[model samples]
Target: MNMKRLLTVVLAVVLSTAFVIAQEKTVDGPVITFESDSKDFGDIKQGDKVENVFKFENTGKAPLIISNVAATCGCTVPSWPKEPIAPGKKAEIKVSFNSAGKMGKQNSVVRIYSNASEPIEKVSLISNVLPK
Candidate 1:
């Protein structure tokens, strides 16, 4: 082949190989798989406290490390496992809602930060608070 054609082929091959390598590297992290992304409390009475558990599993090659869990408001609180979740293992995040002064329709969000492929996941909580 001509020198110019040979150099062009070589450059293309090098770029394709580099891209493949980068994609493989990015896919090596843990993946989070949640059973459900939203929970409905249906109807709750005012001043009542309720809790729900969000289940998830690590479905990737690496261990899942959850860094933090945050709630959208003070009335909602979330708790998660402090240790790393191994591949194919399951975990749970507990969310508690205190309907102290809340009334009417309520919606809350819980943000989870982790070392997984997505890095962050959001779960939603919904309820219709009835007057006491």
Candidate 2:
């Protein structure tokens, strides 16, 4: 009887831990989506700056938290909301591409980290550069 009780206790503890781990989030209750998965600036000249906004909705039950936003290239700048996104609310990510010292087929990627199931999300920007 003692062994049975002990086994049951251990099983309970293990199951609880697994549940918590599975629910671990980088982005809180929010979902990150964009108007488009990618954006094309068409033809841009060197030294020009362009920007785009990514729109998303908080589709989860809890408030979504966006921890950080980063761009793969130094020439690309990205910004995201720092505060919690309440359920059924909306959020946006603003990205800027600086054409300084860059040319040809330029590609940039932005990653967003949140307390979400899939905490890391990616977006991309692409364009062809024209000479000044």
Candidate 3:
């Protein structure tokens, strides 16, 4: 009975370890590799509009499908590719910010929803709005 109990405990430990290792393994799917995830527009006058493009590539074993891109605030807009990005292919996201009523340090965050290993990714735009 003692030997049986010891064997069961050892088996449980091995199974738990295996489970953890499997969970830690990287998912086999599309990976988004961005050239630069953030952009800085420096000092800009209020009411100015700024646009930027974020370039990224599908770096995993599968194609990447971007479903949507959302901005934290309505003053900013984002656009992304509608079609699937094949593995090893590249794409771009265009983001525009209107600093009309916004002033001082402004940080615009955009969330990208995609069918990638990391399903959600973030990019940011920063600027200091100066009064006219």
Clash counts for all predictions: 0, 11, 0
Candidate 3 C-alpha error for residue 85, in Å: 0.3
Tell me the tens digit of each residue's lDDT in model 1 across 49-132.
Answer: 988899999999899999999999999999999999999999999999999999999998999999988988999889999999
Compare the candidates by TM-score and give the number of the best one. Answer: 3
Per-model lDDT: 0.93, 0.85, 0.95
How do the residues 1-132 of candidate 3 rate in per-residue lDDT, one tens digit apiece? 999999999999999999999888575799999999999999999999999999999998898999999999999999999999998899999999999999999999999999998899999999999998
**Candidate with the greatest lDDT versus the true structure:** 3
Off by over 4 Å in 2: 1-29
Clashes of 3: 0
Candidates in order: C-alpha RMSD to true structure: 4.2, 6.9, 3.8
Identify the runs in model 3 with alpha carbons over 4 angstroms from their true place.
1-25
TM-scores of the models, in the order given? 0.79, 0.74, 0.81
Candidate 1 vs. truth: CA RMSD? 4.2
